[model samples]
Target: MEYPGGTREGGLPRVLSDPARLAALEASGMIGSAPEQVFDDLTRLAVSVTGAAISAITFVGETRTYWKSVPHLPYTGVENWQNGVGESFCYFAVGADGPFIVEDAAKDPRTAGHQAIGPWGVGAWAGFPIVTTDGHAIGTMCVIDAGPRQWKPQELETLAVLARAVGNEINLRISLSTAQRALSTAQSALAVSQDLARSLQDSLLPPVLRPVPGLDAAARYLPATGDVEVVGDFYDLFHTRGPWWTALMGDVCGKGTEAAKVTALARYTLRADAGDHLSPAEVLDRLNTAMLAQRAPRYLTAVQATFRATPAGAAGRLCLAGHPPALIRRAGGRVQQAGVPGSLLGIMPTIRLTDVRFRLAPGDLLFLYTDGACEARADPHSPLPHRPIFDEEALAQALADTHGLDAAATNTHIAEVLAGHHGGWASDDTALLSLRVPPNP
Candidate 1:
């Protein structure tokens, strides 16, 4: 192939036009193919993971880059989705047969003079090559930012992992095409997909609560048994600003990757807005607007509390968006509900959110949870004709029993209680967060 600027070293990288690589890509049947939901989900997950403006799966052919999925880009026709190979950053990953990263496209020497930098609005770019099982690099899975920023190591690693997942999906398709090996390969693919789902699901939630000065905080996420797909429950504890922090718990409707998209958006949006807005209601209200603007695929209910440590204990504002009211366990074991009920988010243009002020004196604790706690039901195989549900009253009693326990102990006790109620087989995803002010020392 001839280049307008003359061949730098026999034109573009040979891998972009490798005969064997092209054969593998053709065998995969992804080029110029109709959009697949799984590919789209991966793109969405890319955006969610990196908080990037755009994410895409592109096949770098001899002369054109064929887009298999671009979650944020407006879709046209298949012809419109393809562009000259020179018009994409994907070829960089394909050429390297590995990850291609540029923190600042316009300033990075490797891409400063690149033509795609201007048209594609490339600033910071990171991508990993999607390689076939037979060791042919076919394309790339990438994330794009409109402005320059450094990519984190973990973020790049995740892109690499997900790129492998894309490769696996493509190879799985090829394997299933063989009549004799279909059943055996299909079973293996299911196991790989389930394992990937679990990894991605864990990435969506915080592994450990960030320490809050003068307070003890703890959280847990319990996935339902017998379900391999990801669920929507999530929780977080982070500093909104100096001395002020936000604790949140939410449940998006439905399950699978669709719900994960919303869960990630809610969590990042809340963190982004909480620092600027002290009112829990104001921050949550802004999150609602962001969700609606993004056309979030699922609706979610959440409770947010923004508070700061005080000499007496902690003081904060709390709000609920169609979520179960938070339970407060007093120093002496009295349990009470907090927050005014309001509308859920992502479905309405106008929402009702009220910030109710509350204080956590020394030895008090605020417990936030998803409906899974209050609505937990007995095991499906229970012999009783009518199974018992661990309702709000029972939950309150459970919280009251943990009055003197610290945050970590409180979370553990509640999880145990819920597990016992459901016979170790919860039917819904559950998230629990607790913030406790230690007793005076």
Candidate 2:
């Protein structure tokens, strides 16, 4: 092939003039976006299937090959991984029609003098071009091995399949972005409200939970269907003073910025009060006082539980304010509800709150959730006059059936059940927290 502008002599691959390919890639709007877990997951799967030490999703630009995802490489201070167009195996793969495999770079004419061979120590490689819906090959899904090895036929097939899936995902993202842009112009006020709600909700919720001694904990927050604006459900698990830990789950009365303000106040106030070694009921009382002082047009329903290590296992004091009762699942598969009924917060100056104290034995589980879980409709799209709610009894039964599962597993199972009951769409936000007492030796 007679190269134009550049040739192999200068260690630069011939630059092909494919304007459509470059335009398609630019239109996808994915060149410099933040790395997403979905792409990293694909790269990880590629590494596992190909038995390669490193895997990456690479986009071949005009003068550089940008790595969309490199699972094993640390970001350090670098924002994105990029290499010269002539230096990467993906550069050649992007021009190829199908899977490109070099079993031994040192012995292969096409890759022996490649720039990546020396510094990156790439001895073997397999890459499949990621083709767009319009038939433009813009990038590649590739696997790299440090030592010489033979590429298996099955591995090549798997890489090709993953590449197609990546291409589809890129197309879907592009289409969704285009639609959102069009919608934003039409519904500017709604878009702004949604953005504000999402930002506020995210800021108020705990990003990560700190591990507590002798307890296994997990939590999840699911937004409602068509939830452009954020709902009021939130949960948190945090450590308190010596040997004390607290878990909170709550729901504010409304949606949007007003509800978000109340949510923030409730979470922070509870944390502040609990730090004084106050009981769960006392913390709620203080929070109620704070909410009333604000005089906001919103009410709050919540459950606050303080736990401490005990000789038997873990002891907890739970206080409820117009909130769903927490469920306890015993090691022997029995389920019971705990927490006293009380009036809603921020509604009245004088509120009567009750506390329920219980001890969790080894292998027992504690579950706290928002009302959305039990109130989820069994069939959201049903034409019948009435649709049954997946009530508390149903939730208790499900927990009893999943007796031996760990905290994370139990939460996942419950989410799946909720999805199934609601026909895969809930009308309201749902938050769940699960705590399990570790088995004693």
Candidate 3:
């Protein structure tokens, strides 16, 4: 119920030199294990919201610890959150009743000697030890920050809440796993699940962006948080019948594979039908007609824009339907949204949209994105959600700032800025596409 500060007992103190820490953990534990899918999902959920580099579940078995899901780390993909006796922070992460945290692991004597903390420069950690409803130290739902930090109490509480939920999920996973084993003990199923998610995601995106005549095209698409495979947002570039290189970016308001499907539909439909419509406005109109035939009733938004990179440089037309407008940087020192973006694709009846015409003479840059690029938070419980939004002025500043970066460089810079502002992943799937007119020959 509580949202991040204060100790459970005011005077318990931060020192682990007390017998109470032992007594508290020795009491009845918290959850049970269930199936692999649910276990994998919760492990991902823990790392995501916490803005940590790693999130995983560790089962402290008689021999050693095993990871249910290890999402990210300071190293390569061939590892999990495994540790030996008294080696992992979880060994000392036990709490008698609820959850506990190590805001700065290097500062804590008991865990400072641990490998996951000492040599790795790991300084901040929030751990919620999960126990079977009875008395088993099943695992912990925790976040690991590479550097030291002053963590608020509410953050630990949220981790505890998620850890408890993880308990339920563990039990669910164990149950599901039992049934899964009954049918087949193929551990490969997990790999398959991961594969399908990856395929669905990759297939939805435009893997290769064809080269335009004069402008350098660049883009980046990031997946959603945690283990979920498919992202609800998509972006792509299509070489039409003429010199025009049509590009589209959009987001499905919801989550999961279903949204991914819708996003793919939007990306391609804009390509296949935009040629028939010719202008950005007509393209969106036709898009709405295509989307209205689908099932989801809410915010199905998209931005359809076309760029023609010629010998002298590039020019384009952009139309918006309930999506954020394009960020445009002029040759001089000015920046602005490319045009007046309209409503989302399906929110209203059939209406004519206005197309914003633009010409990128030699150094002009254009950027299009979903809200996820701008809206994300680091310390989720801050007084105000610390997510970043590129309001007109800020967008202009970003564009102006990118005067020296090439198309790809500028695109990367924007991504780094967004990630730095709100941690990572932008709370949702992020799709970004940029076009920069090269210097006149």
Q: Which sections of candidate 3 miss by over 4 Å?
A: 1-191, 296-298, 381-392
Model 1 stretches astray by more than 4 angstroms = 1-181
lDDT (10s digit) by residue, model 1, range 309-404: 999999999999999999999999999999999999999989999999999999999999999999998777877556579999999999999979
Model 2: per-residue Cα lDDT over 1-441, one tens digit each: 222334444544343347887888898776765567999999999998988999989888877777788888875432447767777778776666467889999889877776789877899988988888888778899999999999888998888899999999998987888889888876987777778777777887888777878888999887888857766788988888888999999999988778888888899888888989548888998889999898857998999999987777799799999999999998888999999898799999899899889889998989999998888885546664565788999999888888889898998898988887887678888999999898776
Measured against the true structure, the TM-scores of the candidates, in listed sequence, are: 0.59, 0.57, 0.55
Using TM-score, give the best candidate's number. 1
Off by over 4 Å in 2: 1-184, 187-196, 383-387
Residues 165-222 of candidate 3 have per-residue lDDT tens digits of 8666545655565677766745577678788878888888868887877778898886
Candidate 1 — worst ten consecutive residues by lDDT sum?
1-10
Clashing pairs in 2: none
> Best to worst by lDDT, what's the order?
1, 2, 3
User: What TM-score number comes out for model 2?
Assistant: 0.57
